[model samples]
Target: MPVVTTPPFTISSHETPTGLLRVSLSGEFDMSVGDALSRALVDAARRPGVTRVIVDLEHTRLIDSHAVAGLVAGYEAAAAVGRGFTVVNGGGLVQQVLDVTGLSEVLCEQP
Candidate 1:
């Protein structure tokens, strides 16, 4: 699949050197993208050897509460299966959301 998705938002995934599933998100993150984000995370978390999942949001330009909710849902789904989940590489609006919601230190720890 293409690295940048066509609708909702762009999503790309790969295995990190540390064997973690790294999902990169870009473009607009809103109510429309919420369900898609959850589905993507679910797929990533279930991959073999994917003991951990990292959502890299460095390129994400915008986000809404529903998108954040999807992130939380993704976290919960990963946790349920003993798979670790974290949002990373956040900046700008992405970082702001994580901070405003007090998830900066919880879901993300990027500087």
Candidate 2:
């Protein structure tokens, strides 16, 4: 007998009084979940008084190229509006992928 497992991916968000929106993303980031995330980010960025956006990926299990592209696109869109965008709590494999793809520099990272 064999067992199959499903990848986990979810996005939750909230806003701060300072107009910074924080979105916490968990689980695998693949083509299956890219569009959902893209839509969420786009909507958040378009909201009034959203001067900054932070994507917390501390619990993210995996991220594929499609997800990476989505992130880049989201970052660019936020930048176009003069809004701050950042990715935080990514380490280990996730960090490596971002570094190899040269997206680490393009996307802001928390200290």
Candidate 3:
């Protein structure tokens, strides 16, 4: 029998010419990385010249309640500074959870 391990979570950010700060997340997103996510979101939103923060969850596999709280906190932080915050590329259970929680409507980018 072999023990399996999940890869450490990662957060990457880049700024677009259009004043958007794109933050991409990868790996399981749970309580373990909630604080990091929150910090990253707030930092991204507060970056000079950034008008919006787009969270890309395309590579994020799992998201827990703590993670959801972090997202909400991030949204609030961005809003306080007159910045926009939204999420994209969430699928499967991740999307379902967001939808069920009503965050999909509030935090996701509209099609």
Q: TM-score winner among the candidates?
A: 3
Q: Rank the candidates by TM-score, best first.
A: 3, 2, 1
lDDT for each residue of candidate 3 in 27-48, tens digit (9 for 90 to 100): 8889877887777777777788
lDDT of 3 at 27: 85
> Using Cα atoms with residue i matched to residue i, what is each candidate's TM-score against the true structure?
0.86, 0.87, 0.90
> Would you list the clashing residue pairs of candidate 2?
none
Candidate ranking (lDDT, best to worst): 3, 1, 2
**For model 1, how does the per-residue alpha-carbon lDDT over 1-111 read when each residue is reduced to its tens digit?**
136587657999889667688899988889877788778877787777789998989889988898888788878888888998998888887788888998777788555
**Models, CA RMSD each:** 2.2, 6.3, 5.9
Against the hidden true structure, what lDDT does model 3 obtain? 0.85
Q: Where in model 2 is the C-alpha error above 4 Å?
A: 1-7
Q: Which window of 10 residues has the lowest lDDT sum in candidate 2?
A: 1-10
The deviation in Å at residue 6 for candidate 3 is: 10
Q: Any runs in candidate 3 off by more than 4 Å, and if so which?
A: 1-6
For candidate 3, the per-residue lDDT at 10 reads 76
